[model samples]
Target: MNPLKRLASQTAVYGVSSVLGRFLNYLLVPFLTYTFAPAEYGVVAEFYAYMGFLAVLLAFGLETGYFRFRAGGEWRPETVYGTVFSFLVLVNALCFLAFLLWSQPLAALLRHAEHPEYIGWCAAILALDSIGALAFARLRAEERAGYFATIKLIEIGANVGLTIFFIYVARQAHEADPGSLLGRLWDPDIGIGYVFIANLAASALKLLLLTPQFVSGLGAFDTGLFKRLIRYSLPMVVIGMAGIVNEMLDRAALKYLLPHDDATNMAQLGIYSACYKLSILMSLFIQAFRYAGEPFFFSYAKRHDAGRTYAVVLNWFVLCCVFLFLLVTLYIDVFQYFVGADYRSGLDVVPVLLLANLLLGVYVNLSIWYKLTDRTLMGAGVSLIGSAITIGLLFWWVPVHGYMGAAWAHLVCYGTMVVLSYALGRRYYPVPYDVWRVLGHIAFGIGLYLASRWLVTEQGWHWLVAGTVCMAAFLVVVGWEAWRLRRGASAIPGV
Candidate 1:
């Protein structure tokens, strides 16, 4: 099979898991929005934002480091895995211990001082997830895409099931009487605390499921391997921090930046979070693409005309993202039902955020230039630039405009990073990415989407048909370009 075809197949298999997991997780939006007040949902959002930052710290960028060293072919696979795995175990242990020691102050700082258990439980979840990172990375490296997808879907399924049982069933049990199963296990007043518990349960289950990866083909721990992996992975920690900050600083800053009190801040954030979930379709593609693309890029970089090959792949990546963006935005009136009625107000942010996500997906695809060139510091620089832009905008705009400010902040931040990476990639590892053609596709897709929206209702099956046609038109243009490239390649036959 052609390399691209193989990648596409793997992406689809992985995407099955990704798309389904995201869809299942998306179900939580309506459930949470309907069950919890907006303020309560905001609490969920903030806690998850904290979880996001903690994941970066606990994993310590080892995922990217695994790809980097494993690609370099300098160490035994077992040796590298053992070293990194052991290090993560130590860090996770230390993280939990620190959280135990500081949960009081941390809760106070987070303004949930009475809910230190939230911090403690979340700390445990982060630790388990961090320790399990290598096992998942190994699955990716081994091309076990099916297993990877299965594990993800299983986790999502478990989380969703547990959440429903806890919130809907357990809450009712507690409400009717104190002497009940849910009342015994949970405090009825702790509205959003159950969300963390559900996640912890899910993470623990995922860890248990991945136990076979830990036990199989074990190797003795190596100190030399540890030092090397740390050396390579440490810069990525900085990059990961900046990257997470870029992605999350707006959400994190919103409470502080907004003029509203705690209740209103959360109310605004709840709306933002719920609407943001609608873009998970694009996020699913980006994630599945990353899982398949990282190794694909490393392998492709070894090809003689790797730069041209990368350019070709980049075009396809951008086209898919742009097409998905149009599809989501054009039929957003239908998609908004994914969240409950309370969140419908934030639908306006979807197009802005969807475009931002497209830029982010493009940036991820473009990042191989720095990775392959061993200029990973450029990644740190790129993330810092993006973070600065996002933070600046949040402080300046969010206070006045609320969620709309955040939407624009995401666009500005991701767009800056994408353009900067491309400009620098040209200087360091030039790839002939068809910049004009890619932008033209984006412009054309947007135009077709607008025309479709003007022609059809925003809800019902008719909306789906119109959005599908809009996306199909964009794909048709890309297919024509691909055919022309194929014909040109065919004509260059050797005598």
Candidate 2:
């Protein structure tokens, strides 16, 4: 079987969990938007933004380090897994202890002084999630896509189910009968905290389910292996933290920088965040591809033709992302309904965010050079540069243009990183990526989107029709290009 086909198959299996789970989780956006005001939703969004940062710190990049060394078959798998697991346990324990001591100050800093419990809940959730990261990475390394998908779906389903029950059903029950048991369990005043509680429950459950993997991987710690893994991963921690800043700091910055009251600022953030979910189609695809691609890339790295394989993967990845970009931006009139009417004011940022995420995906594809070559310090440098740009733009733009500034910041930051990574990769470990073809596909998608924006005046069935035609044309072009690539591949002796 072709390596790319195998990867596609694995991605599909992983997507069964990622795509479906995210789609289900996506339903919560509507539910939460309808149940809570924009300010309340903003709290949920901001808390998760902080989680994105803390998660990076807790995991410390050991997941990728494990994949790199484990795939090389130099050290025992148990030793590698145990080293990462034990180290994470110690880190999280220290973190939780600090959270306990500084929970009040942390809550005050985040403006959640009224409910410091939110800080504690977030701490627990991040700790559990960080520990679970290595366990899940182990599954990926072992090629247990089925098990991985099952565990992921279970966690997502539980979180979504619990959220709905607490926010919708239980709240209504409490409103109707304050003296009842359900009412006692449902705290009407704790609006957004319920979201955190639900996540905490789900993450704890996931860790419990992965106990077998965690236990089996436990062995006597190897200090030498631990030191080596940490050395490789230390740069990744910086990369991961900087990457999160690029992806999530916008929300965090919006909370602090916008010149408005707390409620107004949160409302603005809620709108931006809900609209951002419109681009999750592309985000979800990138995540599923990452799940399958990382291990696959490492495993394939030993082959003489590995560069060609990486180039082909990058091409197809960009092609799919461009298609998703066209699909979402063209029919955004329909997808806008995913968020409530209150959040639709920020819908214009969807396309920009989609393009930004597409570029970020390409950047991820390019990043394999640094990871495979063990020049992860270069990855860290690139991410730090992107993060610096992102922060500078956010400080400059969010105060002036609001969330639109954030949208532009995302595009500029990711685009810069893509160009820089490609340049550096070419110098250090060239992958022969067809940069022109990738750019052409992106240009074609953008042209179609612009044409649709110009031609489709009405927002009714006629607009949908025009968008459909545009999407169909985009698909046709993609199919033709894919066929051409396949024929070219067949002509090669061993692709």
Q: On residues 123-181, what C-alpha lDDT tens digit does candidate 2 reach at each position?
A: 99999999998999999988899999999999999999999888877888889997888
Judged by whole-model lDDT over C-alpha atoms, candidate 1 comes out at 0.82
Give the root-mean-square deviation of each candidate in angstroms. Answer: 2.9, 1.4
Residue 457 in candidate 2 has what lDDT?
Answer: 64
Error (Å) of candidate 1 at residue 454 is: 5.3
Give TM per candidate. 0.93, 0.98
Count clashing pairs, candidate 1: 0
Tens-digit per-residue lDDT, 1-495, candidate 1: 666666788888888888899888888889889878777888888887888888998887888777777777887777777778877888899989999899999999989998999889989999998887789999998899989988989999999989888888887887787697676665766778888899899999999999999875465477876777777677777778877787777677777778988888888888888888888888899988988988788876777676766776777777788878887888787787888898889898888888888889889978887888878777788988888888888888898898899889899998899899999999998888888987886778778877787768554347777777777777788789778655543342220
Spell out the clash pairs found in candidate 2: none
Cα lDDT, all candidates:
0.82, 0.91
